[model samples]
Target: MGYETAKDLTAGTCGGIAQVLVGQPFDIVKVRMQTSPSGTYSGMLDCAGGILKNEGPLAFYKASRSSGTLTPLLGIGLCVSIQFAGLEYSKRVFSSRNVASGTGDGSLTGSQFFASGVIAGLANSVVSGPVEHIRIRLQTQPDKARLYAGPWDAFKKIYRANGIAGIYKGQVATLCREASGYGVYFWTYEKLMEREMTQKGIRRDQVNPAKTALFGAASGYTLWAVIYPIDMIKSRMQTDGFSPATGQKYKSTWDCVRTIWRAEGIKAFTRGLTPTLIRSPFANGATFLGFEMAMRVLNAA
Candidate 1:
């Protein structure tokens, strides 16, 4: 396909937004499971059970519906804008270096690919921090009644409590998380699909939608598997509050890991993998499919 930066950007934005809306409830549950590792729940199934037994099925979903409505509205811009920008930026870097000439690698190196991921993540984080803050707080609120009556209430509370910064409480770590996380996610997914197509003697452009969706799901699994540990730390920093100066709260990501290891042990990092493992592939598959289709439809018009 032709690479048009504007078209790519539009598609990315729309896709990211749509994905988040459909999946934020799971997002909320995922966060709670990650952050509250030592709580009553053992795995996603257990946590889900608690929500169902005590709070009911709707309760398992909780504030997601509301948070979904608002967060993705913002998340789309962050996700799509960053992804498009990252691609263009990387393309320029490759052209300038002519890096592929001698190497004959034919695509960006792993490091270059990683760099693009960071750039995309940074872009996503700028918008995501505040929106995510609101999203998490809303989703994990003590009770349905305690949940922000609406996004407006959540916004006001954040502003009133912490000024502008409150809305984006864990922005730095968030940036790190999204940048690195998405960076790896996209690069891995693309590389994997490329390999799969080549191996199957399938034309890249002619890949079937079902297989394509499976590829997207595989990518999600790979992305999460690689980044889930860092994600665990990010969640702690975001919800529990961390001190950047002394690194007192969670400290460096390693420090956070060590502390959790001591306090909660190995099981700590993978707490919510159960539901997430179940939910993420389908969600991500839908997200990729929806995003690509949206782009096609929009471009066609």
Candidate 2:
């Protein structure tokens, strides 16, 4: 209920900024692995090494043009609006006023948090589909391809090629991913935080940055580990060519999953996992910290 208010918008935007600043470099590596059709660098470190060796260290930031911050700053904030707001709405619907107020005999149940997370995750996918489509498209293309010159150009090309459908190429994958992954993410974080606060006999507002970050990191790692395969399929689907005759690598989500498995086996599902797992602790840790600090400052003012 605390996050359901208008202040979450401002805090969420700043949180997203923090997330991108810390996480984009790692994400570029992850996307490269997920979208590389040619099997381009061997693994996460190799990918980083390859970028450093051939494209220059600066090439890592080239995906989003001058700034690696653009996509996450815009995308994460917009996507999380529903997450924070819907969490509050779900709490209202499922939990009694007493439980929401933390005045009841028992604390909020795991089921309550899970229901809220599902609502939030499903909400996130609606925004995530088009946003991530533009992001992955920008990141995946080889340096030579100028088809999507920039975000606007990417939008123009997508619209011209397939109308509105083009912009949402991987909506199904996104829906599946966010619904399941984010559902666990929010539930895990909230449950962890509640346990910690209760154990220490501290109020929710008394949560330290370190504790918040720990919970956030735990939640992020757990969620990604479970749903990463879905993310790979989504990236492939998004970055695929507009033409089905020659450009389509995957006929559908399941087909993409099958093709990747046949081509690379179980390891395929974990491509770029090292960097993604490494990045999550930093990214989500900073996200929660930034959100809390921003909320405190803004609300106090």
Candidate 3:
């Protein structure tokens, strides 16, 4: 189990980073679509087309890929905490209930998954808030034509300008996004597995590793499908703050959201849906597979 855990974590992290690099172009388009709902581009499909036409395929990916090394490591920790910690919490709660009735689903149910997701999301949000803030700033803005010189510069500028609070400008939005995204992600995956298990006439415990990976992937896709719009709003809210010189301002989260909605209408929220749909499942599967393997190895040791 310990071996499995280590192998998975190592493999998962490497795999995740690789995926990010390969798919970073799509990711950049997605981020642009999410952040600037009204700026340009007809839709996700068109957005990619424009990026390719103007900047070449390479232009599709922003600078975030090279700079995003910490993200996957963060992902490893997030998955382990969400899947394992959540599993433990759900098992304990369900086991207590089973003790009383002698009959209950030992596997975490959708409800339990939701609870566990919330816990994991909350924890991840805190850790990721600052990093994500800087990442978005870097990705959306250009390198030569930039605000802060680099990541370090971005941090220092925000700190000097707005203080520590500036670094965490959109923390609430980040928290809202993670909680919503992860909660839906885990809950949907567990529910899908339960359904698949019932249809196959197999116990939940009988589910295998490949199936588990697919289940995680399915859940991840479902989450992005449901929440992409809100994610667009959240990303824009977090990324649009201006430098001290420009003195530009965003009214509030709701205000930013409303402004986008008023200018762009409903379709704006779905701009990044295409690439994200492609990425979320694969990334999510890697995360779950990695964490599960890591825990297995750890337990054996």
**Quick one: best lDDT, which candidate?**
2
Ranked by lDDT, the better of candidates 1 and 2 is 2
RMSD of each: 4.4, 2.7, 4.3
User: Which candidate comes out best when scored by TM-score?
Assistant: 2
TM-score (C-alpha) between model 3 and the true structure: 0.76
Question: Alpha-carbon error at 29 in model 2, in Å?
Answer: 0.1
> lDDT tens digits, residues 101-207, model 3?
76664555567678867766676666567766776787777544677555777788888878987788777777887788778876776687778788989865566
Q: Could you tell me which residue pairs clash in candidate 2?
A: none
**What's the lDDT for all of these models?**
0.67, 0.79, 0.65
Candidate 2 colliding pairs, count: 0
Worst 10 residues of 3 by lDDT: 75-84
* Candidate 1: tens digits of C-alpha lDDT, residues 1-301: 3456666677667667656655655665687798774875666667666667766666544455454354456655566655656665675676557555676544666666667766767776777677667666666666645747656688896687568866776666677678767777777766766687778887655666777677778868877887777777767766654245423466455667678889988878787777677777887776666656656676677
Error of 3 at 191 (Å): 3.3
Candidate 2 residue 292 C-alpha distance from true site, Å: 1.9
Q: Distance (Å) between predicted and true CA of 295, model 2?
A: 2.2
